[model samples]
Target: MPEKSYPMTAEGKEKLEAELKNLKVVKRPEVIERIKVARSYGDLSENSEYDAAKDEQSHLEDRINVVEEMLKYAQVVDATSIDPDEVAVGKTVTYTEVGETDSETYTIVGSDESDPLNGKISNDSPIAQAILGKKKGQKVTIATPGGKFDAIIDKVED
Candidate 1:
């Protein structure tokens, strides 16, 4: 089976790289020092500090591995390469729901970079999936976990 690809913007990939670097160069060493300090407390079985440090290290290593894998399979999508009026990953899309006067704008990004509160949505999300590859002024029906809604694409920008 083929490995799953992590589609993201170049900026997102850079962010991941930076995170990976920090994890390896800073966090990893810090965790090691913590473990060393905890070890000095003696009694590994009952040492709360050692247990906490080990747990933190485990979580950190897991994050490092996940970030590494994402970097390894990253497929950077250049918004400039896509049509200016078309919605796609790395592009900001503005849309208005049918019968609603308010317009919401969101940048479509990869799952790793999704932050709904900041207006960055995952391309895999129902709204993004419905609008992706669609041109401005297009009407699309998005089927989200909550329900389905009709929306009109108002704009697409890099």
Candidate 2:
């Protein structure tokens, strides 16, 4: 099978690595121990604790596998290389809505690193696609859940 590629920032990769380590080193062992104890307690079919522990072990292993795959195909993105004058992944951009006059700020990141609540948006997102390669003072139309609206790029920063 082809290994999937992951486009992620260094910080994001580190976070994922930490989670993987936790799952493998801590959670996996803890769940196995729980299952062993539960097995000693009672009959297999009627033991809810054993069932729950087994489920937890499955989930933990699944997470470990996912993280390993992501690590294998990880692509690190550096925030410093992006041009301050252009919209690109790893760039922090500020914009103002055309008619609403409200200003918004967001950091363009890879799909794996996007966290909307923290103002980090995926480069593949509609808004990012509309703004990519655009410069300050350039207007762009974005189709959002709220509705289609226009925005003007105010500034681009690291």
Winning candidate number (lDDT)? 1
- Candidate 1, residues 42-89: lDDT per residue as tens digits? 989999999999999999999999999999999999999988999989
TM-score of 1: 0.96
Q: Considering only N, C-alpha and C atoms within 3 Å, which residue pairs clash in candidate 2?
A: none
**All candidates: CA RMSD in angstroms?**
1.0, 2.1
**How do the residues 1-158 of candidate 2 rate in per-residue lDDT, one tens digit apiece?**
97667777788899898998888888888998999999999898999999999999888888788889889898887757766688877788999989877799999887867999999999788888889889889999988777888999999987
- Deviation (Å) of 75 in candidate 1: 0.5
TM-score of 2: 0.87
- Each candidate structure's TM-score, on Cα atoms with residue i matched to residue i, is 0.96, 0.87
lDDT value for model 1: 0.95
